[model samples]
Target: MDQKMFCYQCEQTAGCAGCTGNAGVCGKKADTAHLQDELTGALIGLARAADGNHPTGTTHRAMIEGLFTTVTNVSFDNEALQRQIRIVHQEKEALIPRCGSCESRCGRNEDYDMRMLWTDQEDVRSLKSLILFGLRGMAAYAYHALVLGYMDEEVNQFFYQGLFAVGEDWSMEELLPVVLKTGEINLKCMALLDEANTKTYGVPKPTVVPLTVEKGPFIVISGHDLKDLKLLLEQTKDKGINIYTHGEMLPAHAYPELKAYPHLKGNFGTAWQNQQKEFADLPAPVLFTTNCLMPPKESYADRVFTTEVVAYPGILHIGEDKDFTPVIKKALALGGFREDTVFRGINGGTQVTTGFGHGTILSVADQVVEAVKSGAIRHFFLVAGCDGARPGRNYYTEFVKQAPPDTVILTLACGKYRFHDLDLGCIKGLPRLMDMGQCNDAYSAIRVAAALSEAFGCEVNDLPLSMVLSWYEQKAVCILLTLLHLGIKNIRLGPTLPAFISENVLNYLVENYGIAPITTPEADLKQLLGEA
Candidate 1:
């Protein structure tokens, strides 16, 4: 059996290229990587079976969950991955039970070996990589929405089309449209998720959260699943356990339903990449509800709990029942900090603010337009995305810090942690820096930009808005695709582009969309603000 693995579906791949060694950079073992490949292949087979047949809700969910399972840092447990693979197979068999017993065999319903895609021509491989990775990211959003009892049929069907396309032998011309279409569909997916969240939790509003941890038992909830966090909040209510948001969950502070809980405390840590160090000897048990789960350290591994498709082999996983009893017990045993401890963000500020969803921002659309029209606000910069261990990520912090007083910075996702604590002051009554929910809240940013464009009678690009984005994983890939799909050009993406994008495809994007890698903060800021 081959013991090596090949994967480059993320920003931290080896040598800025594919990971083709015994283990992936994310600490996925060779065996686990192989299982993920098998799971992906099985998903392709399920998608192939649904190509002609009308897929049911069960089939759509299986496809979404399967694709999301293979995302970087999502699933490392071989057993759990195998279970998902079996579920895919069962769905395929239910779709076409007679395929295996036919007198004459046709390979149309066979499972795809992912190695075929991995070893294809460079350009085709790059295009398919974009589609597949973008689909994976979109699936995460779809899963979040599904759990909230909201699912878009178009978004669900595209999962099958995307998976089947991954297995097809197609030209760059044929595949490029699918690549962009992944983004197009993901835009709808984000919209669906936005609707699911707003309808379920009420529109988010501007809310300020402190960084202090009161002396009591607390559970730190990470990842991007609001439903899971809500369930935990309900269960831990009046049980003497405080809930603190971490990573992408920091945006929970903005939602009215989530923030109403008095015990739902402030954020605890910075970005996902800092978990290993941040969780070291912590007093509370951290529950991960979605992606960005780094392999836990031995010191705090016992206190880390995972749920909702996030699984690490040795970590305690809270199953579908969403029972957080184990986590509560662990937190109570630890008893939190003996004294009130104030935890500042990376910027040394003791508190940060969030909420500024599309509803909140658009409610003040007239004010924003008046400010921009009067030249009181020169530019609007959407500096957002995930945060990683790369030292270059500090660019976001500096970029926001150096923005002119007349400019407004709209940020989302964990990347906001870089400067969310800094008091950037306000323009009129609005803060110079506004926190716009989580990574998925890129939809909010889009809505706000579209409203601004409509008010000014210009395209989104023509508005005084520049998108300087920093991506660290697959979610960023899909959001980037969504931006390109909307025909919003001149996007500046960095801490280096994805290693999976081949030279030709990179050139194509550069020629058509004017997407460029970010340079120094000073030069980029000057260029963005038109001062260079």
Candidate 2:
């Protein structure tokens, strides 16, 4: 029998149209998506089984690994998905044994159908969606930190709480707070990751990165980890190979320790979604350290290598020792373009600045606070996140363009490309728009917020700041959850709410934290500025 594929796993599915015929918008075959769902179902069962028994270290790691595998654009192998499902099932069966010496057996230990959560009321669905997606996002960061041997106790406990809520039958009243808590817990997770990263690579400092690619062999490294890039730079030093930044990894240039390297050339391409076209026929090899790995096209597939948690079939994997020899060899064999090649971002700018981590932001805190007090900085708009190819995502450009002149925009992730190159003028010797690094660097935003709150002797929400966010993947989900956890209110999120959130869950958000979907920029800006 012929079957059709139907999936709505990402923000930019066809027609905002969930894939429903034979493959996902992401090219996930129907069979693969089904296996993913099965994996998810088994995870819920494992979570339920662990409800009273308490998840051990092994179970916690398994839980995180299982959920992370199903995030959109992460895995496509049916065999891998099935193996994960089997793992979850095994874990569940081990955690909760069958009814012993019972006359009649019941389905109490059975795996739950994920569709039940999907088909629930919108608000209920939305809140649970927040918990699930937020955890999926958190799992990525936790996994990254885990690889580095840094783990937070509070962060790990919340993972269990968030997953347990997903399998719950609670109403909006019950799940909505949990939804917001997802954000809260993610804050700790991001903090843990930030600690893991900065301690491993030193705190990031501001530095300018060129867009000019030097002649001869070079490697391009992308994704959100500075430690991996630092290791690659160390390994590739004096090896006749240069390293460039791609996507979120561009911020590596701003960190003093990383910038101190002579061979760390320049940036190669733009955001994650553009990889298929950007890396096509490129003369140098590229390495992905984390998420947003699209199935590599044959033209550039061989040139791509993955390290840490990221993996692609037939692509080279750099393991625990973090050795990057294979990627360097590939770069040498490619020999790069004969002359210096200049590439511009979408805005045609030749360069970008990054490394504005919490250290840099807090260092300028007095200036920022005085500016706010003196009315020099009237508003702060955080315009940042992963950028996607969706048509309406242009809302970010228009939103940033229309932001009032008195506002200071602090951005992160690949989404800043929408307008990062635009010269918005400066506020008190600081650029009007400052990039705080990649998605994981949202921790910087949190630190800045907390410091501002301390300086003003008030809560972060009472300050004249508003979060205008755009999300494209699991990392964004965790960041959003972190925001909610902080009790900050009135966040404007768009281009569209996740398809995973149900209406009742959406209502819970609206009623409790005033979280609302993004409308037109004019409307959102007016509402944020109190004109609404």
Candidate 3:
């Protein structure tokens, strides 16, 4: 009720219920949080205005950008958020000019107050949260696809539909199916992004990248934008500087088009959660192309630069020019490591491999099938999601370590940083541990699972696979909904269930989908292996 604010969208919220005070657990100031809420409300108004009217490309783009900007750790700059809110408002006015004098104009000032959903009945709030958060996550994927000049009308239209439902007074029964549809639509969105990425960048192949930053002037590119990376690689091509991928950008080394750049060197650090310490006293500028950007620490604050949707106050941001002049100059001025510096993953391994996308994996479908039939591989554990700084996240590391030698571990997103470096070795010819690229690359995992299911003549859930995922934010929300929509059962989620989910909704998932919070690694592995 106070102006302080309330948010519980991420896994590590205050008290695991909500963050209600001066700031959120992600270091979002109260003012910034309010601005995000305002932006969301404005988006809802824009969705309402466009529901029955013709909307332009600009309308759709604003909706996508507005939703993505609200993602946790994506944008912490109130000024940027205000600018987006104004854009949404303008789009709404364009859709229905002089709607202010219309008889059906929205109350509660103008836009739908987000507080209504936050304070609604627990069941309604839970269902709406599922839809809203899932929309936010799906928007990230849609935005990526749009960046590559790829657009799906079905995907874009769903944004308007979902946002409209959020503002409506729909019942639990009415909202339940929409929640699942969010997953269904996100599948299409992810696929659109997959096509865009592969067609534009070429299919990814297995490439082992060192955890070493090469000597000389270099730049650290973080977040999940391949287009930005390609541009940086092109601009810095003949320059004396080197570029290293960090966080989710680590997968860029696997794309054929991106890998062709000689200066697009190795990955620099581990997950986003450790960026503060990993980048402390760094010698080069770090360009953030998307989310998982924490409030920069003053120690390395000067080196932090933002582009696209990721922004923080006092951070120098690269604008629409898509120019890397500032980033390049900073990298040159800083003069990277005087000598080659090798950094090890959390497990102390010096190298990691990625780019095992659907195309690459399915290319060896026969090999994978033969390996499975020959009893060389047992259960597959998909330990993937966003990496966070919360305690108990070590569960992923232990789960991978405790997985039997006969089993295979399929990892993606920044969460793979936990155990990716561990030498799980190979079962047959396939590596026991395979990095499936970034979060949206979950599409690759889905593709591989569907193919394996087809080969085995059974449903995906009936295969020798178990998804033990670690979630931190909204992207995880949409992916979970997608799995649920696929009717995949027995998903193990952790380190903590989403705070936005009420007890009733949690029970519904547990009853219908066999969803459960993850326990100890040994116990979970035993149960998943049918040996409990």
Candidate 4:
């Protein structure tokens, strides 16, 4: 049989060889995936062209848009993908004009083949994969920040450097450091976003968000953005429509300004992967503010809405006005589930607790320090990342399940969905699973780590914290890079390392940082706890 279009970039890709055949597990057709790859290749070429020159605002925006478009489940239309490819080409051609129209053509102006990077030595490939995936995830964050009038110069420049390196010939010794550099730079990028978000929407505080949906009209907001959710909350305020957050949006409850909106109700569903079924025939319209949007099912497609970096054909898109009138109208039309709808999480808990952001964690810094000093808290596990459908991923579930009662699990991103519903009770009133918000809220994890280190007068790694991460996409990649950038050690990553990382690159990560693929929850737990 002819080889299918291989794209195992996501955890749920078909047969672990990518979604070859006709359509992706995400319902993306093969052609759309191919076009996305083309867009990526063109982005590499654009970066190569700008390697020696200044990348203009237009080029930067195009680069961010191109990468954001390729994020899993973000786009499914081939036409949209082609338009993005054209935009990448236009940005590149605009940056570097063919001087004198000479017959001496420069290969530098041509699209950089992704295969060239993919087929290289394992180390080089792995390092490049880190840069590519890291930048892709960073672009998503950057795009969100940019929309909110926040942009960082260093972050934009690294986008070029990271992409340019992907097409370069380099060894493990040469490329390994860039892998970590990607992380280092992403820290700055994420910090910029943190400043942007908190500055734009007040620092998040502890707030009780109910998961129960009140009877009457309501809208479900998902993805990782507070500003968009806030704007939606503002527009819909007093419209008689209640707003429930879903996925990363759950953390919005912690923000003072957002939580103040009485209409902003509790959380709705779990992570993005479960959206199709979760939203099926839902009475209320769902608005996507960012990534992790799976392809729409016919069941509730009409009620789906997109805004800012999120787009779906025929779905009502609330534009810059953030008016949200259309979404509000849709919710009233659907009328939500009959009577009052009470939804429980995957772990069978009717209510899940969040809002334990950096602010809340640091406010009780003295107590946490006391707890640690007294041996009440043995270790801290940052068990977070994008949740997916892999079997072994149950490792995160079991890992959190098996965490010693005294240990604290600081989780962010959708991976928490695996166990967010589980009420592991609390350690001194702090819920066992403290959600620090979306993946971008990894900033909160870093903040808690840094604060704990300060309290102990030691480096972050010296604290009893192990990053047991589950990555399914580029955002996770960038966050992992950020962790490594901080010189964090002994991270346990699963369900499997990215296929893009070559053996050499894996070895470099293992040798330098002691990062390892996850084993059984029992085995990994023992090793993490130092009992193995």
* lDDT at position 196, candidate 4: 85
Candidate 2 lDDT, 4-43, residue by residue in tens: 6546657876676467777777767777777777777788
Q: Each prediction's Cα lDDT score?
A: 0.90, 0.79, 0.91, 0.81
User: Candidate 1, overall lDDT?
Assistant: 0.90
Supply the TM-score for candidate 1.
0.98
Residue-level lDDT tens digits of model 3 in 1-532: 3669899999999999999999999999888999999999999888777766777999999999999999988999989999999999888888877645333334322588998988999999999999999999999999999999999998898998898889989899999999999999999999999999999999999999988888899999999989999989889988899999999999989999999988888998899989889889899999999999988999999999999999999999999999889999999899998999988999999999998899988999998898889888878888899888889989999999989988889899999999898888887778999999999999899999999999999999999999999898889999999999999999999999999899999999999999999999999999999998
Model 3, CA-based lDDT: 0.91
Worst 10 residues of 1 by lDDT: 99-108
Q: Which stretches of candidate 3 lie over 4 Å from their true place?
A: 100-109
Structural similarity to truth (TM-score) of each candidate: 0.98, 0.91, 0.98, 0.93
lDDT for each residue of candidate 1 in 150-190, tens digit (9 for 90 to 100): 99999999998888888999899999999999999999999
Candidate 4 lDDT, tens digit per residue, 23-107? Answer: 7787777667667778989998888777666678888899888888888878766666788899898887777777532221234
Q: Extract clashing residue pairs from model 4.
A: 123-505, 183-481, 205-254
Number of clashing pairs per prediction, in order:
0, 22, 0, 3
Q: Pick the candidate with the highest lDDT.
A: 3
Per-residue error (Å), model 1, residue 58: 1.2
Decoy 2 TM-score against native: 0.91
Superposed model 1: Cα runs more than 4 Å off: 100-107
